[model samples]
Target: MLSLSFLCVIAFFAGLVDAAVGGGGLIQIPGLFSALPNVAPATVFGTNKLASAVGTLSAARSYLRRVRLPWRLVLPTTVAAFVFSFVGAQVVSLIPKGVIRPTVLVLLVIMAAYTLWKKDFGKLHKPVEIGRREMAIGLAIGCAIGFYDGLFGPGTGSFLMFLFIRFFAFDFLHASAAAKVVNLTTNVAALLSFAIGGHVLLAYALPMAAANMAGAMVGTRLAMKKGAGFVRVLFLLLTSVLICKLGWDLLQG
Candidate 1:
C-alpha cells in the first residue's frame, strides 16, 4: 500500500494535470492500482472519479468566473451528457471496449498529428459560427463523448476539446473551459452509478478530493494566464501521452 502522504502527492499532481488539460486518470488510476492491487476494478474506477470530479468541479468554476462560456450550448450539452453518461455506465458491461481500442488508437494518432502540424490551430480565440446551430452541434458532441467516457473511460476531455475546436470553432482555452462542464456531468453520472453499486472508497476519496481541489485552483489560474497557445501545446502533449498509453495497453492485450 502506498503511504497516505504519497497518495496525497499523487492526487495533487493529478488534479494539476487534469485541471490543465483533463487527463488525470493517466496518473491517478495507475497509482491506485499499484497501491491496492487486490481491490476490485470498479472500486478503483469509482475512487478515481471521486477524486477527479472534485478537481474538475473546481476547474470549471474557475473557468466560469474568468471565461465567457456559451450558456445555451453548455446548458443543453450538460443535460444530455448527464443523462447519456448514466445510461452508458449501466450498459458498459454489455460492450467490450477491446473491439474499439484499435479505432481509438488510430483516431488519437491522427488528432495528435494534425495538432502538431497546425502550429496556430487553436491559439487565437475565434468563433466561426454560433447560436442555435452551434448549440446543436455541441449537444451532439457532448452525447457521443459523454457516452464514451462512461463506457471506455479514456481521453474524454481531449476528445471534447478537439471536437469543440473543430466543429464549433472554439479556441483551446474556451474548448477546455467548455470541456470541463461536460466532463463534470459525465463524471457525476459515472460516480453516482459506482456509488450505488458499492464501489467507492470514501476513506481515500476525501483527502484526494482536497488535494485535487487545491491543484485545480493552481492549474486553472495558470491556464487562464497563459492563454490559448499554452493550452494548445499542453493539449497536444497530453494527447500524445494518451495515445502511447492506449497503444501499449492494446499491444499488451
Candidate 2:
C-alpha cells in the first residue's frame, strides 16, 4: 500500500528538483495521483500545493539570503502574480484543461528550442532601466505566468526564469531568485483557494511539507554555490524534461 511515508519521500525529491530548476510538479503531481489513487482530485491537488508551498518557500528564503535579488521588481511582480493566480484558479472550474495543455506543450517546445539554440542566453546579467515600461512589463509577465500557474502549473518557475532572462536581461541566478518570489505568491494564492474549497488534506500535506523543506535547503544552497552557468545548464535539462512530460500528457489526452 502507498503510505504517507512514500509520499513524503517523493516530496523531498520534488523539492530538490523544484528548487534547482522550477519543475518540481513534474515529479510531485504525478506522485500524488499515483500514490493516492482513490483520493478526490481536489484533495490531491490541494495537498500538493500545501506540501510544495513549504519547500518552495524554503528555497525562496535560501535564495534571498544569498542572492542579491531586486526587490523593486519582485515586490510588484509578486502582487501581480498573486492577483492573477487567484483569477486563474477561479477560471479553472469553468474550462476544460485539455485545450490549454497542448498549447502549453507547444510553447514549452519553442522555449526549449530557443534555449538550446542560444548558447549564451542567460549567462550575463544586464541591468535594465527601471521605469514605467519595465514595471508594466513586469506586471504583464507576472499576471500571464501567474494565471498559467493557477490554470496548468507545472513549470511556472521555469517560465518565470526564462522570461526574466529573455526580456529583462537578467542572469539565470537573479532570474531564478525572482522566479522563486513570484512562484511563492502564486502558490499562496492557489493554496488559499484550495483550502477555502475544503480540498486540502492536512494529514498528507504536513509530512510531505516537512520533507520538502529538507530537500529545498540542499538544492537552494547548491544553486547558490554553482552560479549562473550551472543554473543555465540545469534550466535546460529541466525544460527538456518538462517538454517530454507535457508532450506525453498531450498525447495521452
Candidate 3:
C-alpha cells in the first residue's frame, strides 16, 4: 500500500483537478489502483467516491457562496442525476464498459475539437430563458449524463459543463458551478451504492477526504479569481486530456 502522505497528495491533486474542470477521478482513480492493486477494484472505486464526494461538497458550497447557481437546471438536473445515477450503478455490472468506452472516446474527441474551434464559446455569462421544453432538455441532460456517470464513470463533470454551454447557453463559470451540484449528486448516489455493497474503505477515505476538501477550496478560489475565460481554457485542456485518457483505455481494452 502507498503511504498515507502519498495517498493524501494524490487526493489533494485529484480534488484540485476535479474542482477546476470535473475530471478529478482521472487522477484519483488511477492513483488508488496503483496504491491498492491487491485490493478489490470495487473497494478502490468506493474509496475514491467517498473522498471525491467530500471535495465536491466543499467546492459546491464554496461556489454557492460566491456565485448564483442556476436553480432551473439544478432543480431538474440534480434530482434526475441522483435517481438515474443510482439506476446506472445498479446496471453497471451487466454492461460491458469496454464497448461503451470507444463511443465515449469519440464523443469526447468531437466535444474537444468543437470547443477548441469556438473561441467565444462559454465566454459570455447570461441566464437562459427557460420554458417547459428547456426544462425537459435540462432534465434529459442530467438524467442521461447521470446514467453515464454510473454506467461508464468518467468525464461526467466535463460532459455537464459542455452540455450546459452547448444546450443552455451558460458561460464556463456558471456551467462549472452547476456541474458541481450535479456531479456531487451523482457522486453521492454512486458512493451509497458502493457502500451498501460493502466496498468502501473508510480508513483511507477519511484521511484523503480532508486533503481533498482543502484542495477543492483552493481550486474553487483560483477558478473564481481567473473568471470564465480561464475556466474556458482549463475546460478545454482537461477535455483534451480526457480524450487521450479514454482513447488509451480503449486501446488497452
Q: Who wins the TM-score comparison?
A: 3
* Global fold similarity of model 3 (TM-score): 0.97
Clash numbers, per candidate: 0, 0, 0
Across residues 106-221, which tens digit of lDDT does each residue of candidate 3 receive?
A: 98888988888898889997767888888999899889999999877788999999999998888999899999999999999999999999999999999999999999998999
Off by over 4 Å in 3: none
Per-prediction TM-score: 0.96, 0.96, 0.97
List the candidate 1 regions with Cα displacement exceeding 4 Å: none
Evaluated at residue 13, the lDDT of candidate 2 is: 92
lDDT of 3 at 152: 75
Clashing pairs in 1: none
Q: Residue 222 of candidate 3: its Cα lDDT?
A: 89
Instruction: Write down the RMSD of all candidates, one decimal each.
Output: 1.3, 1.3, 1.1
* Runs of candidate 2 exceeding 4 Å displacement: none
